[model samples]
Target: MLAEERMAIILEIINEQKAVKLSQLCEMLDASISTVRRDINSLADMGKIVKVHGGAMALDDNFSFIEHNVEEKLALFTEEKIAIAKYAASLIEYGDFVYIDAGTTTEKMIDFIPQKDVSFVTNGFTHAKKLAQRGFKVYIPGGEVKFVTEAIIGAECVMTLKSYNFTKCFIGANGISVSAGFSTPDVREARVKTAAIDGSRKAYVLSDHSKFDKITSATFIPLNRATIITDKLLDKKYTEYTSVKEVL
Candidate 1:
């Protein structure tokens, strides 16, 4: 595509979502980082956009937000997600009270998890249903569903988490930055994830390698907060600061 055409598409996406990440733009435009960077720089110079840490923001936007629904997320990093989920599932033992956070990865964990004396508490509608179908004990919080991710989150969700404790919690994140920490796109969902992490004795974050170095809009958990289970941990800094287990 022409540089002008690519820039116009980038503007459309950023304006629609208030922001667009470089990784996402690369996928959308089928362009390289260098090409996307050049387009972004040109747009910023023309005052058509504003450059941010890992992406660009709309000129008319007051804040930046880039998010995806369940369908969009389910397709990316399929192999890595499966490996991470498999590793996370291995940590579960009999009679353990587990908390499963909502995400494409954490949702897959239910499939690999053993059918032992395990009970689950979750904020995901899809997760709850899947766990039930798999004949596992499942508890769901009472909250308004966030249709964007098919996850439940609100004050009620937080309240439900307060009453239950978990032996281990497996969660997901949109971004994991050493400085900014684990984050998602929405603040409401972040609260649920924070509560889950706080309530668990052993908390594990299930993420792909792509999540590393990215910083999303909402900050939920700090770096070194939870042991991360991923397909690969390329950065030595992650291990220097906290525990990161590689599955691939």
Candidate 2:
């Protein structure tokens, strides 16, 4: 096939799958790895898609609309996220008060939270509901709900968070970079996460390796403030500023 025809097929695949790994694309197109890489790079430069490590993801405008599309996002890295969540949950003792941030990775941590006398604070409506149902002392911050991420944010939420201190905070970010620190797509959510980190004694960032080296708008917190808990594939630079625990 011509280069344009192969590139067109690649775009169609990414649009249908939302994400495609480099190796998979090469196999699908019956092309050399180098040729496929060039196609991905060219397409990325053209603003047709976003290139992630080892793969490319379709540029969906509603990327932050996670609440309405939890299933789709969850399927992206099911096992890696589960491993990270399990490792993070292990850090929480039975009586520890924890702050959980809003994101798909943080939501997975809910499954690992043991049924104990733990005080859990959150800005995520779905997380708050699940934790409350699980019989933990869950507090949902008072604020306007952002429909995109189904997270409660605003001045009221920040004020409510100030009332309680936490033993640990498990925050999630849309992107993590050595240069940019931690970031999120929405400014309001970033504010909420910043408050959570400040209110906790020890902060833990739970994200998959996919988030590493990526950058998004709105800086939430500095990399120095928290220990990063992520998959083993994270870049070495992340280890420079904070303690990193790689979940196998």
Candidate 3:
């Protein structure tokens, strides 16, 4: 397996087992002790795990959305999010109508988009304001506002999303896995994301590498529904499930 693939499995194992011995990681990844050590070190630097003397420990549960607000999350992976968002914005051509999902990473995209005639539709309160301030044509669906996420989510949002067919969609998710697909902790937001993907001709999931191999509360899209754009393509195995592009 590739280093990226090995790292992903290592994370999955650590998350499942809580703590694992170095020898166990080597046996599971089917690699040498030196190789496993290197992978553990890398994941540690990313703060994805805790490195013990002879093994690694999982970070506190990162699969929940209720724990952190957008303001806090924007600071978590700024560099990675910026890189992935820039690539997602680059895919938007003039005259294209795009749906930008409510997310910390997805919201950063507004700063990087070139001044062009592309229109935007969003459920994020912050995202809509940022896009409007940048002088882009922006639309917001009618729905009940969820203050925690600052997003419009409900039956109304889904209704508005269905009326317009988008050229492309830039989405954000709480977690993702081949088995569970794209997911978030809120079911209402999941409905909005699902509608956005279905309404767009092309769909791109923008997330940092930290999101891979994780499953959250609700599934929004299957792996095949959207192309994955991330800071790193850890596992080539991801390509077997869907299209994945690494920006950093």
lDDT per residue for candidate 2 within 137-233, as digits (tens), equals 8878899988767789999998888888899999988777764577776777788888888889999998888777766655677799999888785
Candidate with better TM-score, 2 vs 3: 3
Q: 136-219 in candidate 1: lDDT tens per residue?
A: 989999998889899889999998998887999998988887655787888788889999999999989899998887767666
RMSD of each: 11.0, 12.0, 11.9
Shift of residue 58 alpha carbon in model 1, Å: 17
For model 2 the TM-score comes to 0.71
Query: How close is every model to the real structure, measured as TM-score?
Result: 0.75, 0.71, 0.74
lDDT of 3 at 99: 97
- Note the clash tally of each candidate: 0, 0, 1
Which numbered prediction scores highest in lDDT against the true structure? 3
User: Poorest 10 consecutive residues of model 3 by lDDT?
Assistant: 59-68
